[model samples]
Target: MASSFAYDILSNKIETRSAKAGVIGLGYVGLPLAIAIARSGFAVTGFDIDPKKIVSLDAQHSYIDAVANDDLATEMDGGRFSATTDFAGLAACDVIVICVPTPLTKHRDPDLSFVEATSRSIAEHLRAGQLVVLESTTYPGTTDDVVKVILEKTGLKSGTDFFVGFSPEREDPGNQHYHTATIPKVVAGDGPQALALMKGFYGAVVKTVVPVSSNATAEAVKLTENIFRSVNIALVNELKTVYAAMGVDVWEVIEAAKTKPFGYMPFYPGPGLGGHCIPIDPFYLTWKSREYELPTRFIELAGEINSAMPRYVVGKLAEALDMRSGKALSRSRVLVLGLAYKKNVADIRESPSLRLMEIIEERGGKADYHDPHVGEIPSTREYQHLKGRKSVDLTQELLDACDAVLVATDHDNLDYALIANSARLIVDTRNVFARLRLSADHIVKA
Candidate 1:
C-alpha cells in the first residue's frame, strides 16, 4: 500500500511540485540530466562532491561544451535548477537519479566505489514515496546488488515504501545528430508501478521511452551496444594491419564495402581505442561474465589487438623516419598533432593519444603534442611529471622545424594543407589526410 505521504503527493497529481528532483554526480552524464529535467518544469538540484564544479555551476557557467550556455543561464535565472556539493539536500527531493562514474580498477576489475559512496549518502536521507533511478553504465544486477542493499539499510523496502529503476544514459559527447531530448530512453524497474511512474516522468521530457522487461535487461542493453563497438573496431584494426602488409589501403576497402547500403556499417582504424565508453565498457561485461564461469573470448581478443595499437604506430613512425637516415629513435624531434581521442572536441579520458605520447618517450624520442581544445593534459600513472606542456600554435615555423609529424586525431580546425605542404614527413593514422587533398608522396598511412 502507498503511504499517506505518497498518496497525498500523488493525489494532488503534482502537476508541478510532485517531483522535486535530485541528480547525483554532476559530471558529463548528471549535468545534462539536471538541465533537461529542470527545463521540463521540474525543480531540480544537481549534487557533486567536487566543490569546484559546484562553484562553477552556481555561477551559471557550463563546464561541458555539450550544454548550451544560454540554456544554463535560463535555468539558473528561473530558479528551476541549482547545484550543491552537500548530500543532506537529497532529503528534500522526491526523485533521485544516480549518475556517478563506474570506472575499472587497476587490475581491470569493476570499481563500484563511487557508486557505493553515493548510495550511502542517499541512504542517509532515504524517505517514503521517493523514486530512485540509476543512470550509470555498469554490469547487470548492479542496481539491485549494489544500490538497493545500501538503501534498504534504512529499513525502507524498495518497490513498496519506495521505487527503484535503471535507466542507462545514452550520452555521446561530441555527436551533433542526437541530443538528450531527441534520443529514445530505455527504462526498467522492480515492478509495474515503478515502471509506469518512471515512464510517465521521462515521457514528459524525452521524445520516446523504451520499457524493457526488467532492470537487468536494461543494463545488458547498455553493455551490448559497447561490446559490439569494441569487437567491430578491433576486427577492422586487424584487417588494417593485414591489408597493409598486402600493400592495400584498408580505408579504401572500407569505403568500397560501405557502399553496399545494407548489412554493412563502417568503423575506421586508428592509433588506438580511447574515450570513456568504447575502451572501457566491454571489459566491464568480460569482468562480470567471470562470475557465471563464462569467458568472453572475443572481447578479450579485441582488447589485446586494440591495446597494442600504440606500439604498432611507433613501429610505423620508426619506418617513416628510417626513410631519411638509418638511425634509431634517439634525438628524434617528433611533433604529434591532435592529441585528443577523436575529432572536433577536447575530452582526453582514456584517450589513446596519451598512450601514444608514452610510447614515443619510451622509444627515445622527444614527443610534443598540439591540440586546439586541450591546453594541458595531466600526467597519470604512465605519464607522471610530464606536465606543463602547452598546446603550440600549428604555424609554419613549428611544422617546418620538426623532423616528422604524426596525425593522431583529426580536428576540423586544423590546417591540413599547411601540414602536407610543410612537414618533411607525415604519418596519418586517422585517414584525415584524404580530406586534405595532399600529394601521395608526402603522407604515410598507419
Candidate 2:
C-alpha cells in the first residue's frame, strides 16, 4: 500500500468533520486527553473495560477530583464526549490512542499484558486510514518494539498504510496550573509525514507540540526525566540518613542549601518515594536496559536506598519510643497519618505508605492509619493478616489512643496542633513538624 493512500484517507475523514476518535483506558491520562480533544471539536469515544467508570462518565459524574466537574458536564451535554466498554465502537474511529496502565510484576518485570491486550483490540479494527498514539509510560523501545509488532497484524504498514506515534503522558495529578491543553506535548512518529500529521493534530488541542527524531526517542524522553528524579531523590534520602546520625537537621540544611540559585533544586527527604511516576517508572527503564547487557546501576541503587526508607523509619520510631519510656516497638500503639502517599488528595497506586505500615506491624507495633481521603485499601492476599483495621476518622479520641503519631505525609487538613498536644511522641518523616512553631521535644524530625 502506498503512503499517500494513508494520508489521503485520513485527510478526507478530517475534512468531512466525521473523523471519529477513540481512546482506550479512560483513567487519569485518557480522560483528560479525550476531554481536550472533544473540547477542540472532535467526536470522542472513550473505551474502558470498567463498566462503572463508563457509566459514571456517561452520567457526567466525574470520578477523579482533579478534573473540573463543570468541564466534564459541559463536554457530555454538548454531545462531543461519550464512553463505552464495547470494542466494536473502536472500529468506527479514524484515530485511536492507548493510555492504559503499564504496571510492574511482583519481581519488578515489565507487565505489558494490559498494553498487549489493548493493542490486539486496536489491531482487530485496524484500517488503512488510522492514526495511533501511545500515551502510557513504559520502557524506551516499547512504542516501536512492543506496540508496533501487535499493530502490524492488520497487514497495514505503519507510516504508510496508517500513521503511528509515541507520545508519553506528562500528566501530573493534583497540579492546578499545568494541564493537557497547556503542557507542552512531546511526540514522534515512524516517519516524517506521520510526525507532521501528528504534530498538526495535537498542536490544535495543546499549546505546544515538540516533534522528536523517532518514536523510540520520544519514549526515551519520559524515562530519562523520571530517572533524573529517582536518582536525585535517592541522593537526598541517603544524605538525610547520614545527617540524622551526625545530629544534623536535614530539613534545615536543605532550607539553607536551597538559597543557592544556580546550583541546586531541592528534593526533600520523605519516608520514601511515592506516587505512580517516581517510584515505579525507573524500574521499567532498568529492566529494559538489562536486555542489551547494560546495567542501570544508578537507578537500581536508587531503588535500593529509597525502598529501605520504611525500615529506617521504623528504627526511628523505636528509638523515639525508647527515649520516652524505654519501651521497644513491641506493644507500641502507633498511629500513622496520611495513607494516600502525598498530601491533600487520594491516590495510592505505588504508595510507600503500604510498606511503611507493614514494617511497623512486623516490628510488633500495632499500626492504624487516618486519612480523610482514603476509606479502605484493598489488601493483597499476602496482607490478609492485617485486614479490617479501618481508617479512623481524624478525631481527638483516635489521635490520643496511639502511643505515638507518625507524619508520613503532610496535608493541609491535618490539625498539627491537635496532633502535637495529643500524641505522646511524634515522628515527622516528611518535615511536617519543621514548619510548625511548636516545641521541638514533642516531635522527632526524622
Least accurate 10 contiguous residues by lDDT in model 2: 380-389
The CA lDDT at 409 in model 1 is 92
User: Residues 303-396, candidate 2, lDDT per residue (tens digit)?
Assistant: 9999888889988899989988687888888888888778876776667777778998888888889887777876643455655557887778
Question: The CA-based lDDT of model 1 is what?
Answer: 0.85
Task: Please give, for residues 360-409, the per-residue lDDT of candidate 1 as tens digits.
Answer: 88889988889998998766544555666788888899987787888899
Tell me, by lDDT, which candidate is best. Answer: 1
Clashes per candidate (backbone, < 3 Å): 0, 0
Q: lDDT of candidate 2 vs native?
A: 0.84
Q: How many Å off is the CA of 342 in candidate 2? A: 1.4
Poorest 10 consecutive residues of model 1 by lDDT? 7-16
